[model samples]
Target: GGAKYLFPGIAGPDIINFTHWLGALVTSMHTIGVKDTPTRRVIHRAADFLPIPLLCIAMVLKGHDLHGLYIGPHSEAFSAAADLSAQLNIITVDRPFNHVLSMPSTMYDDLWTAAKAMYKTEPAIADGGEVIIFAPHITEVSYTHGRLIDQVGYHVKDYFLKQWDRFKDIPGSILAHSTHVKGSGTYDLATNTETPRIQVTLATSIPAERCRRINLGYLDYRDINPQTWQGREQEGILVVPHAGEILYRAKNLSNTATKGPHRSISGGASTS
Candidate 1:
């Protein structure tokens, strides 16, 4: 909905430094009453023009205008659907939990979609807590970017930011993917220590050795039974079924533990 998409979308993963930095700069400018800058115009035009050539070719081949083809006939229906989606996915929790069992569905067949479990569950996890990606079917880190991910591994954003030169050669998308799965944390250059805000454990088909190499914890998927995790929110435990689709946020933004009644979704449940 905003300029954030311009970073990786139109800017592309290559030339990531300039694209990312510029995208942020443009967004800041828009926020500070400087909306009509030359740079912003250029980027907007570029974004608009990017697909025109291909779109034109398609229009010529098909001999039809594509205008209004994508928009639904009923705007009210679309708005109502959007509202329902938000209600279902953007859930608010009363407090952070100590342990979160994030169960990515079959749609998340690879680490690419499975990684979303961490992003979606991060807001509901306490500091020093653990989030287990419980997907026995997900055996690959990424079907397309597995090799690169294996090389750099998953780490907090600062781990790469503080040591930019060492990782500058890698693709930004890959680095972004790494951090998204790792969640948030800090890296101490002097101590050479990486302290993630929460521990991310992969209880998937991926091996323990590989998980260790990638700086993530590992547990055998067979050891976990989803039914056992149900109704345990009072004990600071959370079970999120079809985890990747929902965004869970604690009402207490401090990420601290609080006592409250728990809420249960149809398939997933959490402490509200």
Candidate 2:
């Protein structure tokens, strides 16, 4: 649920903070399942802060005979979904790569959706690494939020945190989008310097000048060929085809390996 609906009439930083808290609460529910006293307590506390009517409706629906609830820390369908997610979304790499070529599909028509390429690939990248988002079709940073994004540019979370007064007027969601694309890093208060953990480059229709202005590196899409990047994982260069949907992680950090039969790719080989 969106903040506008869940936290109706509320605006600015407080709502954003509450939304973040709600997300964390929901994620915690996933670990222990939702059909328990702890989950009910959390929801009850949240209801006090939110509209009581919505909670009343939810409570009424909980006992509805038409509804089929899968309250689970474990269930057959849940296990199957988990297994499928591992096969499709989780790609395990032997080590972090210095360079990654992320290829977004046609669904990513603009930078807003295309940003997933960075999100999905960040965990597999080494410090000071570069992720080249290769999408010839993407010509705008964000169709809905381009002007706001242009004014802010992309930066680490600390950039906004250390200098909150300068950016406090901007919407929290836009600030979040800016930081996520920039990836993790540090910002120095004394020197007013920001250093991102990874360099995000664009190989797209968006111009080099605009890319630079937005604090992103640009490469002419025509100059590169996807074929050259294929089958070169050993060189610390990764090519992820259909990039945005899958998540790439270093093997050491992954809790569960991908199981069952699957076809092999250059950087991601299925782990038993």
Candidate 3:
């Protein structure tokens, strides 16, 4: 039994809001829960958007013993849902994001920096594999952290005083969320960009008989309940982690606003 804190940015007003369900004291309710029911699907779609992951957490908490179909970038939310679901019977698939991407093709500089930091500094994702999982060249990169790791969850709070563009743009596009158990609170980043909400559904449902037409190499399904998947129709997708490290060079770049080594980020959205 754990608590989930959904941020206001990602939580849309559908039927649940992050403040409502996640905000409520656990002492009050225990059944299938929703942090924000009336979630505005508009901000729900962004891939890096965090609120949707909260939804996934809510789902697993309520339906830990269910057969679900999931997809998208797996982060703290994904890990939480998967663990909580506890083999409740779920299948996840991978697909290109259905919404406007935060990480655009034009963001080469930002992407390069994030890729380097992820491979170099972040031990959680870089340990077992090469420190730089992507590429030393940095034209493109991708990686997944199979192990549980910990990173400080400073979010908007730990930002250096100076608002330099170099350190942020990339990690901003991709999610910097941690799957570590200690990461439960919110830390605001510099921007309050809107995201999208896309419900996960099977993009393609072809049976093994059609294997000749398809290459089942990418499919990775982890069964929760052996009873449900036995001779039954079920599928899972493979979602890897897109982890990165935050560059605090801005503080040194401009010290006027940069207070001290500890006083790095400022003017970030307030998160209590």
The alpha-carbon lDDT assigned to residue 263 of candidate 1 equals 38
* Candidate 1 lowest-lDDT run of ten: 54-63
Report every candidate's CA lDDT: 0.65, 0.65, 0.23
Work out the TM-score per prediction.
0.70, 0.68, 0.19
Best-to-worst TM-score order: 1, 2, 3
Candidate 2 per-residue C-alpha lDDT over 162-201 given as tens digits, one digit per residue, 9 for 90 to 100: 8989988887667767877877777889998777777778
Residue-level lDDT tens digits of model 1 in 182-202? 766668899988877777788
TM for candidate 2 is 0.68
TM-score leader: 1
lDDT of 2: 0.65
Better of 2 and 3 by TM-score: 2
Which residue segments of model 2 deviate by more than 4 Å? 1-88, 252-272
TM-score of 3: 0.19
Q: Flag regions of model 1 displaced more than 4 Å.
A: 1-85, 255-272
Task: Write model 3 residue lDDT over 103-202, tens digit each, in one string.
Answer: 1122223222443232212212111111112111222122332111112221221231133353333232222321111111222355742111111111
